[model samples]
Target chain A: MNTSENMKARLVDYIEAFNAADASRVVALFADNASVEDPVGTPLKEGKSEIETFYTYATTVGARLELMAPPRGSHGNSASISFRVHITGQDGRPAHIDVTDVMDFDAAGKILRMRAYWGADDYHVLADAS
Target chain B: MNTSENMKARLVDYIEAFNAADASRVVALFADNASVEDPVGTPLKEGKSEIETFYTYATTVGARLELMAPPRGSHGNSASISFRVHITGQDGRPAHIDVTDVMDFDAAGKILRMRAYWGADDYHVLADAS
Candidate 1:
């Protein structure tokens, strides 16, 4: 099992790598066969190849993450982070999505599965967006 | 599946009920066969009876929950909340545990499963606690 410290550290690294737009860096943290179920009800993104493609687009989109609290680690091989994803809304205005991501890690310290939680109502357009 | 609005409302109610030390109210929000894992990797308290016992003790202990962020809802029947649990530590000093709870709801809008994420290190003693 991965140590809690290790799991928490990796979660922080994930946010940093994603905000840097370094897709490869983000992908490297996952196991080759990791599965990602972003937004909970969506179909899974299985394996690194598909995972890489997903992150590549995500990172290129200019969305940035801002952590809401310290990352939490479980006594088990899981960790979670709550954050806001700043993005451009459909009307080309500034918006942010509230999200919480739970990740399970392998013995090798790579993420094995990741599930993100967010609903349509969680997206909010900035009131002062210019 | 329950709507996102309903799910989020229940999560908020959970916090309010727990803080009010109303164990029955908390248990009412759960299904008859609900399972609660207060800390991930710990044994689960299964069924409403066991869940009530668990919450009865938890609420009686004078612990209070403070939300760290707004509850997050998923596209599916799931929602999450990040919060701090204030309690008296082993040293008889005020401390807090950083926790993130992921709850899955049944079709009728009752919680079916709850998993709380918090490792040992997440428990912090307030430096100013007298």
Candidate 2:
């Protein structure tokens, strides 16, 4: 498969893992030494343990992110995706988040690192019907 | 100059050209037979004349697009930018638009074609206080 297609498949797995609350599946997608950086200001998550901790918290807290845009980047072992996340917030509310996930890939197409960018102020938490 | 820097300079020129309402500045950046596809459903603008027509009408209507994100695509002679646009709607109102500009470049680093993706429904026309 081409690089872009390979990258997309990995992203789909990651998305499914989040939605399903399968922390192990999500953690398995990342390399053992992989790091996760969401936004420029936030501290980076390095190593499988740290990344595992981050995803475990977000997914367990009921953040179900639904993607809006497809993965878009070009001809590299990397892909940057823009997506809108729908999730149940801690306040028992629904929230929308626009995020850019910059990801790097390994030779076998596994995720090496992912840096996410989204500003907290742009989106607001709204009361959920459920 | 590096590819990203080259692409950014061209985009800045394109932005300034829009703000200054200069048709030639806009046209000069694109290649002679370049195609412009704004959204998947719209027809592509092939060649300089069509491109000129599109820009002339857009800028003439006082649509000034200010970029929010620096060029983010990596390596290749391509860049995808995300921006929040502030414009004066025809009804004499201020409007905010969120747009993504996907641009491709040649080996010389000039933009060859551009595909823009944004939905019209996301924004609404409001009365301008000015």
Candidate 3:
């Protein structure tokens, strides 16, 4: 596959791993030195160890991601995936957070950098998917 | 209208003004001290004067934007619009660039910050729309 296709495939893998709560699989998709900055302006988590810890905590809550759109603008060694993450809120109610993750890849196709874009207001409590 | 609807309307106005090549209208949608970071990692253009200059140059080149999808995840005074920008290349060939612009708004519904996400490789020459 070409660069765009390869990167998109990696994105799919990342999302699937997240939905499956397979933190190891998610961490393995990144390069050892990869960095993740969720919400863009936040402090970044660097290296596989930190990334693993982050995902472990995230998946422990049974968070699941459902793609809202197919990956877009996948070109060069970068692409973005937009989705809604479903998780239980502190009140034991279902909440959905809209998120878009932009990723950059290394020559070997491992994610080198990932930035998720979403704000606090992006989260909402939903009654149902319908 | 609520915040999300207001932001989405502003996003539509921005795109319409861009397609119309109305630099002044585009600049007016932003606050006097607004900043634009096209491609996200580039040097930001601060203030309306600089913003107007940027749009003027962009429109002068006959750039046009077509929405590929309606604005997404518009909430809490922020939204993102994904589109295809049509421009002529230096070689006089037709080119299309895929772009997603994420915007943050002030209480007055003026754009406070705008970040466009796309890379050089996102530009592709097209034989036809099909």
Regions of candidate 2 where Cα sits further than 4 Å from its true position: A127-130, B1-130
TM, every model: 0.98, 0.53, 0.66
Q: Which portions of model 1 show Cα errors greater than 4 Å?
A: B128-130
Task: Report lDDT (Cα) of residue A60, candidate 2.
Answer: 80
TM-score of 2: 0.53
For A34-116, candidate 3 gives per-residue lDDT tens digits of: 99987656789999999999999999889999977556544345677778889998888899887877788888888999877
lDDT of 3: 0.80
Better of 1 and 2 by DockQ: 1
Among residues 3 or more apart in sequence or in different chains, the pairs in candidate 1 whose N, CA or C atoms overlap within 3 Å are none
Ranking by TM-score: 1, 3, 2
All candidates: CA RMSD (Å)? 1.1, 11.5, 5.3
lDDT of 2 by residue, A1-130 (tens): 4355567778787888888999989999888878887653467899998888988898887777666555543344565556666776667577866665667778767789786655444355865556
Q: What is the lDDT of residue B87 in candidate 2?
A: 74
Q: DockQ of every model listed?
A: 0.87, 0.05, 0.17
Per-residue error at B9 for model 3, in Å?
Answer: 7.5
Q: Tens digits of per-residue lDDT for model 1 on B2-113? A: 8877899999999999999999999999999999998998899999999999999999998999999988999899999999999998878899999999999998899999
1 against 2, candidate with superior TM-score: 1
Ranking by DockQ: 1, 3, 2
Model 3 / residue B43 / CA error / Å: 12
Error of 3 at B41 (Å): 10
* The 10-residue segment with the lowest total lDDT in model 1 chain A: A121-130
